[model samples]
Target chain A: MKCWLLILLILFSQSTLSADFAVIVSATSGIDVLSSERIRDIFLKKRRFAQGKRLVPVNLLGSKPPRLAFERRILEMDRLNLQQYWTASHFKGVTPPATQASLASVKLFIEKVDGAIGYLPIEMVDDRVKVIYEF
Target chain B: MSFRLRVIVLMTVLSLAPYIVTMIVMGNVYRDDYERRIRDNMTHELDITNERIEQSFQSLRKDMAFIASLDTMDDLLTGDLDKRITNLLVLKKNDMQLIGWFDVIDTDGNVVASSNPDRIATSADSSGLFSVPIRSSFDDNQLGQLTIHYSFENLDRFLPESEHSHYHLIVEDQQVTGPLNTDPVISVSRVLTDWPAVTVTLEQERQFAFSLLNSAENLFVIVLLVGIFVIASIAFFVATIIVKPILQLSGTAESITQTQDYSQRVAINRNDEIGQLSHSFNLMINGMQDMISRLKAENENRIKLAKEKDRAEMLQDLSTKLSRYLSPQIYESIFSGEQDTTLGSSRKKLTVFFSDIVDFTSTTDQMESEDLTNLLNQYLKEMSDIALRYGATIDKYIGDAIMIFFGDPKTLGVSEDAKACIEMALEMQRRVRELKSEWGAAGYSKPFSIRIGIHTGYCTVGNFGTENRLDYTIIGSAVNLASRIEGQAEPGTVFVSEDTQLLVRDHFSMTPTSTFTPKGFSQPIQLFRVISSGVTRSEIVIEESGFSLKLDSQELTEAGRQDIKTRLLNLIDDL
Candidate 1:
């Protein structure tokens, strides 16, 4: 019901757009905290290390719910703008974050890959992934 | 004022007129232009500042949108769990130094996370520049609104002091907040297209901006005032240069006119027009001095000539008066030194004639003085001419009578003088006849008949008068006898004393008219009535009328003549 209301608000007005997302990392990543900027840089492939660890960033699939939240909140881009951003990054030899199929998949990816960061819903969070940033 | 001062003032005015006008016109134009340009500059700066402020807000909105779009926002969407969202907002606030604070509000309008941990779960205060929405990006879902608060200290840095004065204001729901700068040159209001409920305002003080604009005009005024002083001093110097010599010349002219002293001249010397004028003025003064001297000489000469003429007129007038008072013979004798005008007398044989008009006093009493004078002049002129022509010396005139004498001064002999005197007397009576007829035609009704008495006597004839005035006349019994004989003479006849008749008996015939014992005479004297002289001395003719009356007063006494005249008058009355 809350999602429907949010959908109704976005359909009617982009000026009233609202978003909330979280930045997550593996429990063994050795990064207890991250600023919103470091989170965005890692997800956009602009950064590779934080706290002296080689960082890897993961995203849900483009059709999945958290991918939009990750791109909009962390990367600060819309879907079309993100696509254009990736295309421009390709010429610079950079790529988008690695994709996962679901929230659990993102959680599992963050859990296994050391120095890996991803985004997830608050409810989908557990002790396996560390919450670095939230909006 | 003096001429030099006047000239200086005039020149200063003449030269400064255009400058003063320009100052007035330029000052007005500059003031007007400054006001317009200051307003325009204020408006222009306001526009630029308004654009910058809108850009700042857009940047702030973008910052808010970006922070809301974070993947961590899903944490808040699906239950924030702890202080994770608040920590993220703290970092975001640090990124935007202008932000007062940031709060992530839940969809239910609760402050889920904020830079201030105390603000968490508190209902978000929406009072700020703008409150942007946070959305679920993948589903286009409304999550919460991100309310941004701006720090005035940081935002004020966006406006510069070089803009003279500026203020930023917000108008929301008809309520205004921010700096209230009244008396602003420009007040600009802007409603951003992205945020309709929010309005931004900018303002600048007119006084502050106009102060900078006044600099050019103030500088011009200073320069103009200094120029005026320099020009006025120059005008004063020039006027002194030109007017000094002219003033000197006028001073000389003024003194000359006051005293009529043409000899004075201006003593100024210069190298300009005034020098030439001074030279000409001196020449004119010299010429006037020469003319004045010449005119004075001529005037003196005229006065000397007039004095000579006055002396000559005095001599002529004295001669005329002396001739009127004295007989021509006596006057000539004195003037010619033939007789001395001293108080003395001498016995000389002189023929004297006395003549008088009948009823002369009655004739004058009946006439006006002008007519009487005419008759006397005509009679005296005729008698004098005849007397002078016959060489008789006129003694004097007593009213209508004349007594004259011949001999002594010039004489052929005593006998000849007597004969000439008798002839003059008869001719005088004849002239009266002719004159009376002529005078009657000129309004004189009464005719005059004359009687003459002649006497030849040895008489004292010389000056007999006081020391101051002399009377050159004859005196003694011979002169008296002539007067008495004239009184006894009948009208229209000449009576002669025996001495005269004895001297003229051969030249004229006489009638034994009367004899009388005259006053102071011891014996009666014989007299004769002489009727003619020169050609026909006497021819007694008689014509008888029907009745005849005759009287011989010689046979009677004086009382007998009077008695007979009264008896005859009574007899005529009876008849």
Candidate 2:
């Protein structure tokens, strides 16, 4: 009975940790929040401008934990589905979001650029950027 | 040296000197030009190789820059997670056949994209053979760099390779491509303008670079040898042609001198100068032969002429001795072909003269035979000289008597001949008187005197003898009468017959004398004594046993008169 309780506690902490990521922008962006659909449209190049300003979107490279969580929870797509969607948008002259090789590069890019948006682990996000969305 | 050898040497030198000189000069020029061309060719090849290498590098840089300028490279701003720049790098590497990999490095020094998949997301530095900086398309800030790991093998395609020559790519003082030649006759290098640390070099081997010059030198030597041989051979042939005749000529001359024979001649076979020389030599020999034969003939003729001259001189000597036995008129007539020498006679009116030495027999009995002969010869010689002066032809000498006549072989008229004979008799008496005094002075008390008789008559005068012996004489009564008249003459008196006296009576004074008849005469002949010429002058005549004289004052020179007076005084003192 104790081993069962311990397994359940481990499972709960793992979920909490997996969900600790955010979509952030520069603090001076004057953007207060974003919805999942709007964030998806901007990342997939369906919406080129937001809040009367052009949006620049950035992503962590490959399948990082934050990138995977953003793709699954906000974009509502698996890794294969998201790649397929970008591939389809590619023929329409639409490109997927820009990518950084590390979470640090993603955080730095959002902090330095206005109208810039990117996903990072909640622990890596700094005060130089504002959190627009969380998953 | 022999003429042929000398000529050959001279001709070889003459023909080959210019050839060798020109060959050397041209060889030098050709070698220089060939070396220059070879170097120029090497340089040109190196230039082409350098240009190709440069062009390749330039094209690579341009492609890199073009790729770097692409917005696809802007993916470097997002770290190129989509592999957009990586895909482009891979494509460029394949298209250019690059042997090295390409990478896109971000400003953070991380390789975001790479042609080599293993290098993706790797940290990289911008150190490579070639690099192009990536800039942000939005603000032109430094983003990343497009870099290539350049392989020297890429330049190997432009490097030319051959057996004797090779090309090398030197990068930062290291040989990158192509084999390094250890010993090169020629080395050409060019540094890359864009890639400053790289150099292109061409190396050529010694054998390959100078092959043409070596072959050309060999050919020149061969040609020079052949030319010398040909020139020497031609010179030898020509020298023989020219010298053979001269040798033959010298030989002929030597033989001729040794043998002293001019009959030898050179054979003429050509019309060149040598042949002309032989012809002239033959002509000279012919002339010599002709002269020798003519001289021999002249010598023989001279010998024969000398023998003939000797014989002619002997005949003349014989004729001269024989002439003493004949009268001058008769000898001249016979020799001149006017008279024939045969026994014959002729009758003609002639004046005949006879002379006899007085007391010759008595004087001969009293003296030696030699003294008697000398006295008789003296008396006859004086009388004969007078007789010849009067144009008398002497018939013969009989002992102490002489018989002569004028007329017949050559004559005046009979009267004129008679007158000449009387005058001759008178002069003979006078000479006899003079000889008496000369004999007294010569120590002979008794000397010779001559009495002459002359007559004018007809006689037979001719040659009378056998064929081997002959005499020219007169035989007739008139000749006997002239002898009988001489027998009546005194020792120093002249007596003439009436016939002679009558013919000379107008020119001389004569008195009738006693007549005498001979045994062979039938009638007595009247004779006369001649005294002097018709011009009468003071004269003297004296005769004695030991003294006699006859003088004509009208004929005496003053000196002669003085001489006579001196002689008379001496004679009177002696008396």
Model 1 regions lying over 4 Å from their true place: A1-135, B1-48, B71-131, B143-155, B162-261, B264-272, B298-467, B472-481, B487-512, B515-575
lDDT of 2 at A82: 85
Winning model by TM-score: 1
lDDT of 2 by residue, B296-362 (tens): 8998999898888888888778879988887777777888877788989889989888888888888
TM-score of each: 0.46, 0.44
Rate residue B518 of model 1 by lDDT: 94
Residue-by-residue lDDT tens digits, candidate 1, B1-575:
97777877787777778877887787788778877776676667766766776787788888888878765665564345434567778987876654477888888888878786787778776575577777653334677888876654454565565444655545454534454555646455566454566555556666765666467657766876787678778978888877778878998999999999897888855667788899999999998899989999988998988888898688668866978877777777777888787898878899888999989998888998998898899899999999988889898899899989998677879988888888898789778877977988877898777888888888888777898987778887888999899998877778899888877777776768678989999999999877556335223321122232434444778888789889989988987
Overall lDDT per candidate, in order of appearance: 0.75, 0.81
Candidate 1 matches the true fold with a TM-score of 0.46
Best by lDDT: 2
Off by over 4 Å in 2: A1-18, A27-29, A52-54, A77-95, A111-115, B1-44, B66-131, B137-163, B166-207, B223-242, B250-265, B281-575
lDDT of residue B69 for candidate 2: 80
